[model samples]
Target: MDADHLLTRRTVLATATAGVAAGAFPQTSVARRLRREPFARAGTFASGVASGQPNQRGITLWTRLHDIGASERLGMEIARDPGFARVVHRETIRAAAVRDFTARTRVLTRRLDPGERYFYRFFTRTTQSPVGAFKTLRPPDSREPVRIGWFSCQRYEHGFFTPHAGLAAEEDLDLVVSLGDYLYEEDSPAKLAEREQSTGDPNGHVETLEQWRAKHRLYRSDASLQAMHAAHPVIAIWDDCEVEGNWAGEGPSSGPSPVGPRSVPFSVKQRNGFLTFFENMPQEPIGSERFRIYRRLRLGGLVDLFLLDTRKYRDPQPCEDATFEGDVPPCLDADRPGRKRVGPAQQRWLTAGLERAQATWKVLGNAQMMMALDIAPTRPVGYDSWDGYGAERRAILEQVRASGVENLVSIVGDVHTFFAGELHTTGRIGSPVVGTEFVGTSVSHDGIEVVGDEQQSALVTDRIVLSNPHLRYAKFGVRGYSVLEARPDELRVDFKGVRSVLAPTSETYLLKSFRVAAGTPRVRPA
Candidate 1:
């Protein structure tokens, strides 16, 4: 590698040094900060409050203070109850200008117990935000049922984030997992105009840091997204839309038919985008790994969620010579042993983590569908998914089969469809169902819109099941998310969606429910 390439590589792997200015307020100023009447009502916490990257002892608390005046330390209060009578932790945290006036901190307090719920809010000298809450992760050996809501692929312009409003209202959720496509990067003049009807987001493709921040700001401004975060702590493993569509590591779109506008050099845009993500969201330091986002979160004693980064370090799209989109040409390179999806380090990390996990359930928080969805008889393969890289996918599945994991579940998104299927050593049957996958549909992105009636929906669902035997349930052309409930012996998922996105409404209904028993490798109606 050239010296520049080598330096950029090092920067990517080095521990992120993102920082805000030192606390401008003196220690005594905290008392005054708290005493001031709450000023920042809805507009101050416009982006909203969020918590993520949780471990046994701690979780990160995030909020972006709109303080253009000067740098200052904000007062924060976290309590076990809404009354604030049982205050767990209180401190002064700084919102640094270097971090774009956003304050994100990894809070580790000994007094805070694991497997518990806590509420948090921020206060400046003049204002206070809405009280948001999150639960600390349980010890891996704790034998309690874990509740998680999995969601992905939301397009703000497409419709209202109504599901988020519903999800926030849910009282029984422990946490939420965003699978990917967190923000849509494709913005044109027309699309931006339509999106502005909801919030003020910059129109056109997101290339610069300003534009990226604008996009994030727009998404966070949505009451639905904010409500979801305010309701339950969410840990997100971003997919392609985090940067550009179908983007692999080290560059923008590749292959013969790449989509989206070409970005700046891989080093610049990747660094900015990744840093913006950390600054904007409730994420901990990525350490020396740079842009890599594959990490593990231990939830209680029964669940280990390995949030895999499928987009950051993947090899180029397979079959560069093929036609665009759905075209599958005779590409001999897909099965090559060296074609990588999660890169070498991340793959090793996930494999080792899964093998070493003692949790009763190892939940792979994948951003894309793990199962192979054959378009078949017309077009055979999909380049953007696991179907493109056959060798690496099977390698993971082979380990799943050989490792004898009691309960391995992969929850995925990105297809804008809902599917509950068995994970076999291969895509075909008789390959041994080693793992199971519950694929949630989009949050607001368009699904199969043609199926507008009950008959069409049934027909579409039947065709999918008939085409893929391992797929027990399939719902195409829907916009919603899934709630995953994991116990020692069984895992149940409820596919919930809204009726319409064109209009603003919060009502959502359960479209389907499936339960997967331990060691069964099949999904049955719940």
Candidate 2:
């Protein structure tokens, strides 16, 4: 990467976290206390609501109070019954200016029965917001089937977020797992046909902490995202674009075309983005800055979903040449300096997590692809993905083999395409493929735009599937979400796609479906 680009990225983010500490906002005036509710309606400014990180015992409720200058004190009422006539737990929390007046509270009430539906909504002033319904995870001791919606790569400007709306109303899922790219920091300018008006912060590019928070606010303001939050809890993690495109820790922004550094080649500023992210998003069991996002959530005994942090601790992506410029040229050498690769610590953590997992289904919530790809292997290639780091990818597969974890399924995003495949330890393993992976296409971002002709695109997809025997399906042009249903004896996945995201309300369609037996790792046609 160029030195100027690296310096520019850092300079833009400096002091962005100012006035962000706890209790940083000034006290409210007496006159405001007596004022009527602001943003009382859910659809008006708050846009939507969401619940996440659910355990059998409790769940976290989230809503942002969208107002200028003043902060709003939001209240939530969770009830077993839909009517507020019988309230289970009522929480009145302060949504201060520091966190964009977003109220994230944990409502611990025994009344929220496991696997049973419950209604919740925010209250400000005398007005009540729209009521949203969600369910709690079954107890750890209970072993029952669970259904979840897994998706990633939701870019705001590329298209509409109709997928979220579809998932919100079209399915009865316990939760939605978002692997990454919840918000894109920099958009693909050439690909955007229309631009969304800037909300509170400046538009162009989001580099500073304020810009990132504002981007999150912009996304949360969407009705579809809020509705999904209202219906079911969301399990989310960040991809490179969430902070920066292909950013690996604190490193040079761009460099040698595909094989560069084996690990982080720059500073600690990259890690700071994760800190800012946790501030806006609701997460649990806060810990040290080093390896925080690599945690596991168990849905009773039916499933154990491991949300991985692929960008945080990984090494800088490598390029094919020492002094390449812009995107790598096709038909160039693959043995260049800047190939993408992961560090040892993250690899070890993933191996241990997979090895120790005892759930019937071990689903990895990964941000990028785990399977090897032949994307310009014979020429100059981009190493920001798994293709950049052969050794690291090999070690990861080896660990999976040694661990012998059954029903290992990986749900991924980032490429803006739908990909289904099996993960093999190596070219010589008995099964060749040890686990199955389903990559969700982008929610709204530009998808397969570079591939124009339908016949040509279909041929490319076919070649990718044909060359990689483990790859069963590939849809490069679809845009949508995924619904994963896990039964005692089988696991089924349905890929739902939206027609076009350029408009607000788009029609949805079923793109494809796949399933795996209780103990099998390969996904068969459902």
Per-model TM against the reference? 0.86, 0.81
The local lDDT score (0 to 100) that residue 238 gets in candidate 2 is: 80
Cα displacement (angstroms), candidate 2, residue 95, comes to 0.6
- The digit string of per-residue lDDT tens for model 2 on 352-373 reads 8888877788888888887755
- Model 1, 1-526: lDDT tens digits are 7764453233322211111223423456644553332322222667889988776678889998874544455667688887565777766566666677688878898878888888988765445678888888887668889999989988888877877877887776778988888888776333344465322233356767766777788778887888889888888888887777677777665664233344455456567678787787787656686655677877887788888888778888777524334444656776678888888888778878888888878899988877777645223346777766778988888876677776889999988989888888765576777888999999888875443688876775576567687888887766888898888898888999888766656568989988988767788999
Give the CA lDDT, 0 to 100, for residue 444 in model 1: 85
